[model samples]
Target: MQITVKLFATFREGRFKQADRDYPIGTTVANVVDDLAIVPSEIGMIFVKGRAAEMDYVLKENDALALFPLLGGG
Candidate 1:
């Protein structure tokens, strides 16, 4: 299945802002993050198809995913 991944903030540094990737059926959000070399601790939020999703959320074909890194600063 093919899915779109959108990166935000620092997450886009040295990486693309968006991409279309192919993964096997039943692939989870965590798998994509790992493939992108993003650690779980750096993830602030995940959205799948515009809805908040967990790392264990299964990715569906043509799904759109957005990843945001943890924000800091007072």
Candidate 2:
């Protein structure tokens, strides 16, 4: 199984912001976050397959996953 991941915002400075990586099938979006050693607070938005996805979303091979920081005002 293989997954391509894209990291944005502060996540880029972490040890898991690689453009792509390989993980076992049935990996959830949250698993990817965990692999990156990312804390929940640092995580903003999650886009799976071009749509807003929850952490429980089961990731499929070749699925495009994107992570971004939560938008804030002021």
Candidate 3:
């Protein structure tokens, strides 16, 4: 399956802003995060096709997955 991943905030520091990547049919959001070397604790929000999604949410072909990093402000 091909998934489009979008990274936000600090998540794109050393990674791309968006890209289409291939994964197995049973791949989940957590799997993609792990593959990108992102710590789970650093994730602030997740969206699949513009809807809120969980880490264990299974990805489907052509799904748009967005990941946001934890934000801090004083």
Candidate 4:
């Protein structure tokens, strides 16, 4: 399956802001996170097609995923 991944905030450091990636049919959000070496604790949000999703959420072909990192400011 082919999915579009978008990264935000600190998550984009040394990585792309967005990209199209290929994965197997059963790939989950957690699998992509791990593949990108993103620490789960650092994730602030996960969205699939503009809707909130969990780490275990299974991906579908042409799905768009957005990952945001925890933001801290005063």
Per-prediction TM-score, please? Answer: 0.92, 0.85, 0.93, 0.94
Which residue pairs show collisions in model 1? Answer: none
TM-score of 3: 0.93
lDDT tens digits, residues 1-74, model 4?
Answer: 89999999989999999999999999999999999999999999999999999999999999999999877679
Q: How well is each residue in 26-51 modelled by candidate 1, as lDDT tens digits?
A: 99999999999998998998999889
Candidate 2, poorest ten consecutive residues by summed lDDT: 11-20
* Residue range 1-74, candidate 2, lDDT tens digits: 77889887788884556566898878999888898888877778999889999899999888989988887778
For model 3, the stretches where C-alpha displacement exceeds 4 angstroms are 72-74
Two-way lDDT contest, 2 vs 4, winner: 4
Worst 10 residues of 3 by lDDT: 64-73
Q: What is candidate 3's lDDT per residue for 21-73, written digit by digit as tens?
A: 99999999999999999999989999999999999999999999999987768
Compute the lDDT of residue 59 as modeled in candidate 1: 95
Score each candidate by Cα lDDT: 0.95, 0.84, 0.95, 0.96
